[model samples]
Target: MSEEVGRTAQSGWEVGVSRTLPYSGARLWEFLLGREGVEVWLGAGVELPRERGEAYETANGITGEIRSFHEGTRVRLTWRPKDWDHDSTLQLTVVGQGRRSTLKFHQEWLADAAERAEQRAYWKDVTERVAAALAER
Candidate 1:
């Protein structure tokens, strides 16, 4: 697991978590953007369309709108939990070769130190689950 936390002059605090997976970039993209794939790894049903301004929500009630999308490459979206006062931004990027890929995930505009820590742990666990699910495939 590779993780970083930093303070940005304009964004307050940001958290990043990255992993290198033994899967092709396309495979990883499928796992992230495909309905069945997300349901298995994230443990929630998602309605995601790879288009700007498209809305998405998890079965558990997390909601967001797509900010940017590049097929098989990257996705940037607004992520807002039901209780959050403001939305945070999440970006997922993938780069890889024939059979391996590096996944970079970054979340910014956190509210405070406590929220930062909480998000760090949550993302860590989520990424671990994703990797495990990929391995099982």
Candidate 2:
């Protein structure tokens, strides 16, 4: 059998979407954690705790816990929609060089290939929206 896309023995199913933005890592990091960017990336009403292991819930009914956070670099966390039976690991990363940076959204431990594809599309749309929003500023 052919190996499945985004499948791994350790992580099960996964998906990643990224976009290169014309911004610094520090700037993108701040925006991503800010209220407006939180709504764009995470969800509305999400106020992530500063400490690891702290739990959070969004207005749309998703729940998760913080795993780790690296200032101006990346954040790793657990993500679970209200209807999902299993939790997934999500990592947001920004790597900047010179005047541009690449923002990455990576999620793993999904239930199956279908969910992987679904999340892939979701993140792609999110990347586009984020790019547009940043361009306006």
TM-score for each of the candidates: 0.89, 0.96
Candidate number achieving the greatest lDDT relative to the actual structure: 2
Across 17-123, the per-residue lDDT of candidate 2 in tens digits comes to 99888898778888888888888888999877767999999999989999999888889999999999999999999998768899999999999999999999999
lDDT for every model? 0.82, 0.90
* Residue 1 in model 2: lDDT: 86
Q: What does the lDDT read for residue 106 in candidate 2?
A: 96
* Superposed Cα deviation of residue 18, candidate 1 (Å): 0.1
Flag clash pairs in model 1: none
105 in model 1: Cα distance from truth in Å? 1.0
